[model samples]
Target: MIKQTIAATAIATASAAVSAAPLTLEVFNPGEAAIFPVASVLVKGQQDAVLIDAQFSRGEAQKLVQQIKASGKRLTTVYVSHGDPDFYFGLDVIKAAFPDAKIIATPGTIAAMEKKAAAKVAYWGPILKQHAPQSIVMPQALQGDTIKLEGESLKIEGLTGATPDRTFVWIPAIKAVAGGVVLFNGLHVWTADTQTVESRKQWLSTLDRIAALKPATVVPGHFAPGVAMTPDSIAYTADYLRKFETAISQSADSAALIAAMKTAYPAAGLESALAISAKVAKGEMKW
Candidate 1:
């Protein structure tokens, strides 16, 4: 009787382990319509969900809130992957909707957000107008590199690298990546921020690190509509950066650089990004 009881307990434990649900991901982006096509991913477990980055405009964040409500999962945390305004400017809406959600980000990211949030708002306010956030909701500094959803771990990578502020999330259970500023897809890769050659090189290295992980799902922070969220985006971004570098060295002015990139990526969207990035790269405009 004792032997039979032990066998039953072991079998039950194995069954429970096999039946445990995996975390699922849902991504929301405003596509090319709203300024930047920033992606916000909702990582849902059995009972809880975690949001990665908030959208740029208040209206878009409201849309994201509707999606979360539709998911029927309680949101526990909202993790801002980068310090860019487009990533967290809509946090005000998110906070209002899920007031209990713990908004968090890497310490470096938090610092950057704090430093630039006001200036960014001043610059973009006129353009966004009605869709602009009435106020900013700052995220608390994340204590560690890991965020837990259910029993699974969402690891924040690239913290110790050259660009600690620019990090991505690695969800091991799902073998997925939520790439931040380091990755772009179906759009002209933003180079205005990483104007220095070394900075661009570090960005490339970050992409390679992500590629090494071989994630089944890869979500680019900024991508055009209909672009597949896959490893192919990584390749597209890296190649664009290389081409931009070549164009910068060959061209004498921002116009030439812009022409070169447009020729290289005729189908890519976000010409505004390419124009500004080319100007910054050619030293014709300060970003």
Candidate 2:
């Protein structure tokens, strides 16, 4: 159930980025920026469509819009998933094409965007004025834990195990789960320099949350569309944290821990975890 996301997944891969019917998801790839957990598209009939995540750049965002138009879906709304700029910033370009679509994000995401917007207005204001056009609407409908939209009910809740903003959406009708950031498979478990110390233990328990759903298809936040949610996605990331933490706590140095881990999993994000390891070595990383 765990697919290899090597160069085999086709780097810089572009597959029209569109769906054929009831719904098809695609990988905007985004090249070096961030891979995996592309975008999630839901097409219900011709007049109803919803997208989760706009991807990183203006180009991918345009393609996503085209994909929706190609499906003849009326591009109703987009769920930001979280406030990571790579995930949400492209909403600016997206709105130019689909002017009426609204974004659905948690309170955290909304506040983050507003703060960023304010920062752009105050300090980076010139950059915002020159290149970043702010047109996408602020997220609404805190919707707390769940939201019923267009016959599709999305339950939004954070899994303490992943990042604090981690969210998962459950579609009971299809037995499908869109675990935004909580569970990631075949890609770096983290990209945004998350607070991973204590999140490690919580990450393990979060798997229990996804497992409780017993989903058939799991939609990861970064890469492609996924099925086989359970241990395939959750367990892998948890295992990494567990092993890394154990080794570090045992006074393993950064080089030793990274070498052992890299040998075990060629794709282990050792480069990504270097800063983390240094912190652990210095006792700077909290448990």
Q: Top model by lDDT, which number?
A: 1
TM-score of 1: 0.91
How many backbone overlaps does candidate 1 show? 0
lDDT, candidate 1, 107-215, per-residue tens: 8898988898889889889988998889988889898789999989999999999888899999989788989787888778888889899999999899999999998
Model 2 per-residue lDDT tens digits across residues 94-201: 777887887678776777677675553354335334434455456674555665555656666562334545666666655566666565655544522344566566
lDDT of 1 at 105: 91
Q: What's the CA RMSD for each of the models?
A: 12.6, 5.4
Output the number of the TM-score-best candidate: 1
Model 2 spans > 4 angstroms off: 1-46, 116-137, 159-164, 191-196, 224-231, 251-253, 268-287
For each candidate, the alpha-carbon lDDT, in order, equals 0.82, 0.55
User: Candidate 2 deviates by what RMSD?
Assistant: 5.4
**Candidate 1 deviation (Cα RMSD):** 12.6
Q: Model 2, poorest ten-residue lDDT window?
A: 1-10
Candidate 1: where is the Cα deviation over 4 Å? 1-21
